[model samples]
Target: MAQADVEVVEDMNVEGGPEAGEAVQVLRRVFGYEAFRGSQQEIIEHVIGGGDAVVLMPTGGGKSLCYQIPALVRGGVGVVVSPLIALMQDQVDALRALGVRAGFLNSTQDIEERRLVEAEFLAGELDLLYLAPERLRVEQTLSLLDRGKISLFAIDEAHCVAQWGHDFRPDYLALSMLHERWPEVPRIALTATATEATHTEITTRLRMAEARHFVASFDRPNIQYRIAAKNEPKRQLLELLREEHAGDAGIIYCLSRASVEKTAQFLVENGIAAVPYHAGLDPRTRAEHQARFLREDGLVVVATIAFGMGIDKPDVRFVAHLDLPKSVEGYYQETGRAGRDGQPSTAWLAYGLQDVVQQRKLIDGSEGDDAHRRRLSAHLDAMLALCETVECRRVRLLAYFGQESGACGNCDTCLAPPQTWDATVPAQKLLSTVVRLQRERGQKFGAGQIIDILLGKKTAKVIQFDHDALSVFGIGADLREAEWRGVVRQLLAQGLLAVEGDYGTLVLTEASGGVLRGDRQVPMRREPEKAARAARAKAKRAPVDLPEEALPVFEALRDWRGRTAKEQGVPAYVIFHDATLREIAVLRPASLDGLGGINGVGENKLAKYGQPILEVLAGRGTTDGGDAAGAGSGSDHAPPEPPDDIEEPPDDIDW
Candidate 1:
């Protein structure tokens, strides 16, 4: 059949193409799923009918399939505009494993590689082609696309196009040209995180305002969200990992490069395998660290926000934040990285008064204009509200995206409801201290000195300033230092108190007048006591939901998968996700036909690995003898050791 005629038939007739139900057929024959999830089937049909769409789904919600199935059902090569150059190879490898002819063009490719992919694309042999968004600037690339038989455009991580978003990429600003140039070709923009404002921004910036919008619920019920007061956070993180997530694949996000290094080193010293990632590292070192995290099991990656945007690893068991995120969108995006395989996981964060002070200081010192600073403060304010709320975290989180949901019963607030006390008196006392210092002494002080004076403790700094002699010195003695700090934090969150200067000195906002005049009530969330916290920690360490006899079979299948992944030099999940393996072990499929019916076992995979999977299930393959509880879901084998003297490369190297 000629290419034009084939394209016309596929585009016009969904029921009577070469085969009926082509999208479903591709889903089963290639990606291996029985039914489409959520709005996936509707989105696929719309795109296959040559219509544009804006898709808002949570991470691991199968956004890829929304575009992939359409690309397979429609004619020509589907051009994917992706920002993750480093991960393109893994994506293509995964597609090729499913027997799809996939390729990518990026700066990482050599002249020969680029020519080969270009030739394949021009010949209409490539089913899908991935391109970095920046490549569209090159005339050669635009001309190249014009010569090829083009399918729909798939824009992944579409939130980056929003100028005010947490993960904005300047290269994405030019993406609207895709619609302008290819007026007839359909386009689909997909993102895992976006607020209502960001959603509108994406639509406006991408010129997709007329496209149908599909917004899915942003709840990941399998992930238990927990945020606690940051008491010695490094030690707290260590305890959490030791008790609940030992030997599990996880990501620990820090706010700075220095913190990333310290956290990784801390984990390594505590006998946990870990690697550090940040933009400051050389490109090669970053790539190698990313490769290790993807290929090995039970490896922890300590990183800044630079990591985890396009990471496809499905078995990450936890995501911990030692520092507070700047915004709710960022927090959701980072935490969404965990439990991609739909297994139970933890999204733990250690927050404290210092986090708020530090974030405020950053905004003050930031280079943006007044309007930009206001935007930044708005983001921080929403995040603080989430941390301080006594209600369900999941409900608050989903509501930020304009999706209303009831209490999830799984978050920290719902599982152990916190006591909300009338802190109006404490709030007045703290604000009074600030006023006395500013009016009488003509001075400003940080939270430490203020707390010392409130508690009437004659510490060195207090005595140095003669703060012990103040009129309100001992009035707050009824509250402990921690309780006073909580009052201060709550006041800051309420905007009655503000942090100023590099030292984060306390100052009063316009809202402080009502509190001082007894016209406003301040309610504060009481932090969970030590015993309650310990109980929750213990509960999180419970075993995975699997039958006793199936544990060994699961371990054996993981062993086989690890070995196969190593043989192919791809990530273990690329062969088959842990969720898929868990089901296989539970069902113990005895025949090839039965194995093919599993969720992730596509035709190519069933024909290739089905027999070996059965062998592992039947006890023919070698199994690791260690207790499955100790090893968790990752492989028992350790990855290779990284070099000790890794250094930053020259400036010319492309990262």
Candidate 2:
């Protein structure tokens, strides 16, 4: 893609930039926020005072402002090292819309574009300059940076520096050079998701061990966490979109390219606008699909893990996982892509027995030494624990990041608590069957055969092996096959059972001896069938809390935004977020000053789009696009109360 055209506001780029004490002034005038949120002010002031820092904030926690405001106050271009080459344009677009003179140098830019950006940087005409980490490897790029007046180095998505992180990038290992080369320049490394281990790894690898670390709470209470047993996942996903999130933008993640294609096709066949994205698609095709998903409304992108790394779109309503994620970090990062507007959204997953079996088989057959396999296994174990936990999902998730949080009353477990049963006898029976088959018959088999023998199915293979005559045979007949599968899955999750070989044969782990010897009791969660029913009964779509009269104004403003975004060739949120529009509708601002007082209406935006927004508010430029409110305002039922534990930001804060 060519560079996006941005009309730089010359007045904001004056020499001797705003003083450090003017941080709040810059925040209000440039970004249009009245106050700092959480630790944003602390982080911004620290950076502006020439102190290195590390920030671990949630997705919608306003991480950008931590560096953007500091860069604006500290003067000179803030050199940002980002891994998102595809998203740099959108980031710069958003900043330029705020009247911040931002530019980027990446592979997507032609030589002319790169030269122009480099010229702007050398002349001190840009406020922020974004570069992919890999670009710094080039001597010319380093020389270019050395020649420019530097402000600070901002590393976005710094978790990629962790060697064991889910989204590790080798290019990030070279980022430590920023510290060595520019010792006087302040630097800030930021990520939305990281464990204590990953955090330490980032600090160590990025040479920021002494930097003041700001670890915000990992909780995103606006997202309703739900995991259901997989039964016709495609159909379940279809029902979720149609019944709850119809006409809303979402992302559906699958485990394989073929699954991505199939799921996208399924949704499109069912009359939902959807597209497929995976590594298998051609680069241009992937780019087109991503652009459509970003620029258009209510478009679903079915992808593997290859997508959604630095996506800045703020209105994604749901993120559904058809297959299991390998780790809580991966799950958290993917799910964080939803509810970024601080609106009610969903992080839904469809997990089942096959998911467990498949993951184990992949690990066993993976090309790694024992230590690597062990690491992968540990990550999977944590994820499985989260999926199978009877406690609150959010609590378990936050616990993984070394944070403590109470049971969020919105997750699946809190809403409809699953029952736990003592499955010691059933576990013993299953392990005994595996033992008998291994010691007596000198044979091993997959779960299907093992389950058949346990239930005494007397299938042809069972009879051929004379398994029906075994002492353990028919011992588990009291439980149905589905229930037995659940037992095996739970056992695997609990590490009492292990899967081996290409066919996923059941085996005993070191911990299984205690269960087999009656030294330990196995407890398992009963599937939350009632929870599923209740969730289905209640509409999963988020409700708009605006007064009935304000709904139309909100829709009209959205219509105007969509058109303006199309004209500017940028994502709609680059113009203004839904949260900003909702407040505008509620307040019904009547003039430029009134509209300018709203959050997200920065000085540049106030001058550029203020009149148009006021026109829409006054019913002059209103269009017939009430579909904008369909996702959140269709239901007649009152909107659900916001969770008590979540801290609400001020009405004037930009999401």
Candidate 3:
């Protein structure tokens, strides 16, 4: 079915709400945007016209406006079912900043606060109401909804409804009841991450199979994707922080809580303002650290995967992973946190053979049946293939999600394509050795032992097994141990080798037979020279340039934003994102009206923060005094956007 255009429906009465044409007006006056991007205009029109939708837009792609605008144009309050309280709070705060009456019902709210929000909802004063799925499951909450007029139901993070999704929410399983009870209400489910299976599961579970599916491109071109072999990962991460992302707010994801603590400490010791966050930490400490990460500038949060699910920090300059992510979907979502202001950012990872082994063991040890294990294995295999692939990482990443994309020229492979060589001989030798070891000793050995035998090392185990007597013992002497290790890693990635048992013994898979019999040729990626790799990594750093004159004013605005956010006890971006500040710096708006003309500065924000912004722009250096004419409203100049990558959203609701 084709998407409907946002046309003026003549003679159509929306009962108590604004007509269809009023969406654009509300978009401009309230949220300060004059148009929509991609299918946002159509999606908003459909939902407002009482239709359902399943939107798979990327993060920072104006997914929120698809629901928010319709909610405003509709007759009643838009109830958004969110999985996390922090996410709800961020969305609500951003909506309120736009002068929209939005509130959230969650466990974090006290009785009085909840009551006030409920009263507002019943009075039909709220444009949007964000609710945690857990709260929505309550009888009283459902009863309250029955008592009020609802515009539409929006399910954010809709992928959570899939039991197999990385961020599955048990509470979301109860959300189907919303449709069962309110059969007349239109519903829209939205997520930034979902594969075909997850997508189907979402629509099936939510009973929105008939909902129009709007899937935008998953490519985040601004985020540079680089995967390097793990070599002293901590030192590499430190170098990444120092040389690439100095004084930038980012997240460094570790695989374990202990690693998170250690990495945070290491960063702090190295002069980075860093904090540790994980499920193991006390709630207060975690909350405090998360708050600081959000509230302060250039603070790094070293954490496990648990840290970044609902993070609304738009200017997270980078997302570095000290360990490999479990799947492409997980990696995509985790990295999607960065560069959300649309500025250039990086998604860097340190992957190695150990990651392969650890992930394999994790899958094997997981409590699941064979089918589940097989699915996990497939996911791991795909992840490994991506890490080891010489093709564009972005291309492969998107392909994994069922989207065919051309070479991005942004990922590590496209920037520095890896060299490949025919490794049929070496592969045959390695597989023959494994077969020899199994046949001669009726046992499989680890890669170390196999490489030892191949490199003609006379170790005790080799001697004990009398491996020196074998014909293949010295066959691989021409290749160095590291080269041989590469061969093994590649073979494992190719499914020609498998690591079994706690000892990580290498065993031949069925695919090994073709190579051993010379029926197939093996092509392997040659590890880039260290100097070349370093040079490529250096070249991949995104350039950030500001005019020399605008530098001081930018810093001044940042200082003012920091101070204001501190006083308000909110993230600096909550006051104004760095992109907005950059725009202000470049434009140097003269007055309140000039500031009001800015894309992100709505009437409420202009009135609340106009004078201070003007003072900063008038060379006041964050002080309270400046000539109002030099710093004040003069013209309705529309400030140009920050950069090509730093896209400005037309509206609010930081989804």
- In the range 541-617, model 2's lDDT, one tens digit per residue, is 44556876566666677778878888888777777776677778777777898888776677988999988887776
Reference-based TM-score, model 3: 0.89
Tell me each candidate's TM-score: 0.91, 0.91, 0.89
lDDT of 3: 0.76
Candidate scoring better on lDDT of 2 and 3? 2
Backbone collision count in every prediction?
0, 0, 5
Residue by residue across 475-525, what tens digits does model 1's lDDT show?
999999989888888888889999999899999999999999999999889
**Which of candidates 1 and 3 reaches a greater lDDT?**
1
**Order of the predicted models by lDDT, top scorer first:** 1, 2, 3
**Tens digit of per-residue lDDT, candidate 3, span 1-655:** 0000111010012122234377777765775444556677788889999999999977666677788888999999999887666556656666676688999888777899999999999999999998878887689999999999999999988998988677777889888888789988999999989999999999999988788989988988888888887778999888887877777888898898899899999988989889988878777777777667766657888888877765666767789999888888889988988877666788899987777777877887888799888888887888888888888899999998889989988777776788899999999999999898899779888888889989999999899989999999889999998788788888888888888988788888888889988999999987666533553465445455554445556666777877886686555655776656666766777768777766666677787899988876765433232322333433312122221111111011111
The residue pairs in collision within model 2 are: none
